[model samples]
Target: MQPTILAALAFLVFGVTVGSVKIVNQGNEALVERLGRYNRKLRPGLNLIVPLMENVVLEESLKERVLDTEPQEAITQDSLAVLVDAVIYWRILELERTFYAVEDIETALKNLVLTALRSQIGMMKLEETYASRGQINQALLQQLDGATATWGVKVTRVEVQQITPSRAMLESLEAQRAAENKRKADVSEAEGTVESIQRIAKALKEQPNSQTVLQYLLAQRYVEANLSLGQSANSKVIFMNPKDLTEGIADFIGGDEPNGGGDGEGPKPT
Candidate 1:
């Protein structure tokens, strides 16, 4: 009877010993407390604790965690309401502080992130908000890192997911941009016209014989004009060489004596 009683006590002790031993997974940490007071943190793998004396409160994951936040409404400096969404990457650095320093790290992190976003958006204009997303993200990460440091949480990065303005505001902005582009296009067209006119004038000034070319061009214009006028039925077409027309006009005006035809010998009768 004594031997059986001793065997039972030994079996109970063995069971208690096995229960006291805890194994932590890789990329994780275990926080142990003695008599409800702060105690040592256990690294990954096998760890032994005193049964009924030391209690393991929580196991913290050291691997990075991704937290995607819901969309939040933020008012810009221009008083325009914009919807902003973001995501944060974080991980716990200190096991003890992660479990004991904060009751709920995720909730606290989300609130902190939202407040930081609001503060950032409030200081920036609508255009700046869109243009400075990178700056905003960096600022948010920095702020979150600072705030969560005490809670043993490290913020790796913060990303802006979406930023949207109201439909009316977007339409107004589009109209404004369109009007500005139209004004620029008109100014460019007018400048191009002026440049073309200046180039033509410069070319004409450089070549004095351009007047003869102009006369040929005028003859072509007359032919085209006559063809167009014939469609009116009340118009008449006249055909004459440009040299003969010039000479006839000179004679009618009693200007110079007529030159000999094709020989350059002496003056001849008209």
Candidate 2:
């Protein structure tokens, strides 16, 4: 009878020990409840509980967690349809609220993020969304942080993974860019031609005595014209020495006689 009582007492002690124990993992916190009411939170490492009156309700991870959201359809201010995807980085800051206040923290967070993204996207144009990804990310983080504060979740960062426009919009943008580029090229070409002509005219005006330059240019034009005639037999040919022609024209216009007397007639008559 004495051995039986000793063995029963040992079994009771083991059962109490097993039922009153709790272990919290690293970077985690365990919420303890007593008599179905709010109670203290257990920090990382081993903790004790009352055998039957106290209960371990929930465990909250303190480590940063990544939540990748599904791609959502959004419309821009410019009436463009876009598909946007993003990710959120968060962690539980207050273990008590995280475990007790929110029924489903992860789902609530995801919904909050989606709502914020749609609001932000709706306010921006398609081009703005693409160009201002940083702004979008910041806006998302701020909005999510505000919404999750009550749930004890801290949003560390939010990042936009991709923003894609519809096929029709992309094609329209490409066409617009191509047209702009072509217009620029044409304007540049026209400007270059105008500059070349102006430079040539200025050179000609500055050097009025440049008959040699004029003759060279004329000869080049003649050669090009002849080549373009393509073996035509009826092409007319005109030829003259530029220096002689220029001197003759100057003497005629100035009413000046030739330098040398012809046949010595001038000396005899005088």
Q: What ranges in model 1 sit over 4 Å off? A: 166-270
Per-residue lDDT tens digits of candidate 1, residues 163-258? Answer: 898676788889999999999999999999999766654554356454454456557766787779789867776776776654453333222434
Task: State each model's C-alpha RMSD to the native.
Answer: 11.3, 11.0
Across 21-104, the per-residue lDDT of candidate 2 in tens digits comes to 888898888888899986899888888999789998888779999999899888899888888888889998998888778888
Q: Which 10-residue window of candidate 2 scores lowest in summed lDDT?
A: 253-262
lDDT per model vs. reference: 0.82, 0.80
TM-score of each: 0.62, 0.62
What is the overall TM-score of model 1 with all chains considered together? 0.62
Clash totals for all candidate models: 0, 0
Model 2 local distance difference test score: 0.80
Most lDDT-accurate candidate: 1
Off by over 4 Å in 2: 167-270
